[model samples]
Structure formats: structure tokens, C-alpha cells
Target: MRRLLLFLLFMVTTGAIAVFSVQNATAVSLRFLAWQSIQLPLGVLLVLVAVLALWIPYIASAGR
Candidate 1:
């Protein structure tokens, strides 16, 4: 039951992201101080950030 709940949660989150990406399909770039990034879709950037957020925690816990 817990696994099924998690699966449903994941599916809902994925669907939300998909709908958001489609609605906000605008190219953008990042600039910080003297550093800058190449243009990319806003949705791609959001997904990358989400992946990094998940990955960092997994790496930290594994190091313990």
C-alpha cells in the first residue's frame, strides 16, 4: 500500500511538471556575477534542479 501511494504521488508530480513545461516553454539563460549559462528551456532547467535536489541528498546519506 505504501509503495502504491508513492507511485501515485510520483505520477502526479511528473504529470504536473509535464503540464508546467508545456505551458512555460520559454528559452532562458542564467547569469551570476561574471558567470553565465547558455540558453535553455525553463522546463529543462526546472527538471535539472529537481534532479540535483534529489541526488545531493542520496549522496549525503550514502556517505554516512
Candidate 2:
């Protein structure tokens, strides 16, 4: 039952991302302090950030 719930949650999150990407298909740029980034699709940028956010915590805990 727990595995099934997790699977459903994963499916919902993926579907949300897909819908968000399709609706927000626009070019965007990032700037922080003196640094700047090249233009990328908004959805791509968001997905990258999401992946990094999830990965960073996993990596940190694994090192301990």
C-alpha cells in the first residue's frame, strides 16, 4: 500500500511537471549577483533546479 501510494504520487508530480512545461514554454534568463546565464526554456530551468534540489540533500546524507 505504501509503494502504491508512492507510485501514485510520482505519477502526479510527473504529470504536473509535464503540464507546467507545456504551458510555460517561454525563454528565460537567470541572473545572480555579477553572474548571468544564457537563455533557456523556463520549464527546462525549473526542472533542472528541482533535480538539483532533490539531489543535493540525498548526496549530503549519503556522505555522512
Question: How does each model score on TM-score?
Answer: 0.86, 0.87
- For model 2, how does the per-residue alpha-carbon lDDT over 1-64 read when each residue is reduced to its tens digit? 9999999999999899989999999999989999988999988998998899989999999999
lDDT of 1 by residue, 1-64 (tens): 9999999999999999999999999998888999988998999988998999989989999999
Clashes of each: 0, 0
Residue 35, model 2: Cα distance from true site in angstroms: 2.1
Report the Cα lDDT for candidate 2: 0.93
